[model samples]
Target: MYAYDTITEAVSDLKKRGYTKDFNIRENRLACDQLDTHFGHEDFEIIEVYRFEGPSDPADEAIVYAIEAPSGALGILVNGYGMYADENNSEFLQQLHERVRLKS
Candidate 1:
């Protein structure tokens, strides 16, 4: 429920507050490259989401997610909002299509 002006600021503050996991988009799930672990939707829950838009270009659209795993692991997922994230050919991403919709 917090408003962040930039992705970097949101990420930095969230990490400081314990959302420390760095989750990368994988073909079918989220991966913590540092921990050598893969997380399915069932393994974690979305705690908060932040959406941002460019003052001019549409390409600047993005979203940030605060997430927590059942095992007490925490993380963030920074994703694009425009065609970049839309064209991802991943089943897991497709499943989240409705939930992460961005407003123009």
Candidate 2:
């Protein structure tokens, strides 16, 4: 695995490499704002992941996941970790995190 100094840098470079869509965490699925699409855990696959820390603040901790959907759509999911994380869909989030962490 490689390292990225910052999420912005990773995002810019990933976009250049074809991770163009942005996936947001929804209650029970991932949503691509640009494509207006929703995907459940079974509907997509993780291609890459880039984790980042605040250096001093835990609030800055986040993970960028390169994702691919069944329709051949590619995207990125940016999720924060630790305290202050959204838990309304904790189960789905945990599964996604575990899958990538374990696979990667």
Candidate 3:
């Protein structure tokens, strides 16, 4: 794992490494607006996870996920954690994380 000072820096470096597409949690799946496609938890893999916590504000807590689909699609998902996180999104990500852990 790479060390990053901020979420912006992490995202920038990831994009440079080809994680371009941006993904959002859409119910139980990941949605890429640029591709107008939705992917199930089993459809993609989380390559890396970068977490950032605010020095002052708890709401600033965020997580960046480097994801890759089976079809060779690479993307990133930026989601909030802690108190500001969405319930369904958190649960969905948890499922993906479990899958990755099992594979490991």
Which candidate tops TM-score? 2
C-alpha RMSD for every candidate = 3.3, 1.3, 1.8
Give lDDT tens digits, candidate 3, residues 36-89. 899988888889888899999998899898999777889999888888988867
Candidate with better lDDT, 1 vs 2: 2
TM-score-sorted candidate list, best first: 2, 3, 1
lDDT against the true structure, each candidate: 0.78, 0.85, 0.87
Each candidate structure's TM-score, on Cα atoms with residue i matched to residue i, is 0.82, 0.90, 0.87
Q: Between candidates 1 and 3, which one is better according to TM-score?
A: 3
Question: Model 3 segments beyond 4 Å from truth?
Answer: 100-104
Candidate 2: tens digits of C-alpha lDDT, residues 1-104: 55789999889888888889889988779888788889887689898898888978998899889989888888888888888578887988988878876895
lDDT of 1 by residue, 50-95 (tens): 8889898878788888887777788898888676675553567665
- TM-score of predicted model 3? 0.87
Counted clashes in each candidate structure: 0, 0, 0
